[model samples]
Target: MLELLSYDFMQRSLLAAALVGALCSVIGVFVVLRGLAFVGAGTAHAAFAGVALAYLIGFPPLPLAILFGLATVWVTGVMEEQGRMKLDVSIGILYTATMALAILFIGLMKTYNAEVYGYLFGSVLSVTSEELHIILVLSVLVLGLIVLFSKELYFIAFDQEMAEASGVPARRMYYLLLTLIALTMVVSLKTVGAILVFAMVLIPASTAYQLTHSLRHMTAYAAVIGTTSAVGGVLLSYAWDVPTGPAIVLLATAVFFGSVLFSPKRLRRIVA
Candidate 1:
């Protein structure tokens, strides 16, 4: 393990995994509280579609991914807010459409693209120094914005209607949450891949929920769990010669089940 850390690429991979994991888990708190799990999955597919198109066109994938992810979430939010369609319905439609788009884009490519598959299944062990810097900058920006708007975000997450009643700009805050989620997904695409990134976002936060009811404490616990999972996953994957993304997610899943088994709420229920 110590020998692994001496390698520059391993250091970069660990740093990238930690940043991506922390960012995903923190944003995931609001996502879980707001009941937007489906949105996470949907935006991932949309972002992947953008990546596919970018590869086909010989363009950068990051901006295109951000564009697609943001578009999907905003459209879903608008539909739900306008009562035009239920949130799940809109997300369900977009989810399938985006995945189909990804497939179509891949089919259009004349040759097999191993690099594109990297984005699909994740290759955190291959993270470059440049990508590490990108991950760091975005992680800081997102985490900072989260701190700046923490109170309002929490308000909207738990009770948007009441927050709006109190003039908290709940609608705008809701959109901001969606935007954050999209950005988080896009930033994490390389490290965790499109298919498994949602697990990175959802699992740590969900596990934290099993341990605490207080929002602040839950967020703190989730960050720790997520970081641990990412770092630990990278280490284990290297040692075992396994996939990094699945390893991270599986570790988090184990923690989640452990939390559930010993949850205070569950114990209280049993006592009663």
Candidate 2:
């Protein structure tokens, strides 16, 4: 296991996992709090469409995926605000449309591209140095934005009406939060893939949610859990010759179940 670091690809994969894990879990706190887990899933599938579109048009997939994800979330937010549809319904519509687009684009290709499979199921072991750099830069950007807007985000997450009453710019903050989630999804694409990325976003934060009521504590705990799962999964994948994304998600699920079984909050509620 120690000797695996000697390989450059292994080093990149570990770094990618750690960064993606931490960022996804941090954003996931808000996702879990707002009941927007479906949003994450929607954005990830939308990004898959973007990836397929990029492949079709001969462009870089990450940037295009980011655009696609942001567009999807923005549309969802707009529809919800306009009272045109419920958020979940809007998300479901976009999710299916984008997934269909991805399928169509892939089908149109003259030859099957194995790389697309990597995006679908993850290929962290094949992470390139450039991809690692992008992940690092985006992780820093996402974390910084979160810190800068911590109070507003907290207010909006817990009580949007109250936040708006308090002049917290709730609507703007809502869109901003969605945008951040989209960006995080894009950055996480390679490490966890489109299909499994929502697990990274949901499981860690959900686990943390079971353990704590404080948003700060929840975020911190989620980050730690996400990081641990990602690193541990990578190691297990290496040892077992399994797919890295599912390995990471399974570890996260295990942690969540563990938290559910022994959560102090749950125990306190029961005892009371």
Count the clashes in each prediction: 0, 0
Candidates in order, TM-scores: namely 0.99, 0.98
Give the RMSD in angstroms, all C-alphas superposed, for model 2.
Answer: 0.8
lDDT of 1 at 75: 97
* Candidate 2 segments whose C-alpha is farther than 4 A from its true place: none
The parts of candidate 1 lying over 4 Å away from their true place are: none
Write one digit per residue (lDDT tens) for candidate 1, span 1-272.
Answer: 69999999999999999999899999989989999999999999999999999999999988899999999999999999899998999999999999999999999999999888888999998888888888888899889999999999999999999999998999998998999999898889999999999999899999999899899999999999999999999999999999998999999999999999999989999999
Could you give candidate 2's per-residue lDDT for residues 25-141 as a string of tens digits?
Answer: 999999988889899999999998999989988999988999999999999999988998988999999999999999999999998898887888989999899999999999999
Every candidate's lDDT: 0.93, 0.93
Residue pairs with backbone overlap in model 2: none
Q: How far out, in Å, is residue 178 in model 2?
A: 0.7
Error of 1 at 15 (Å): 0.4
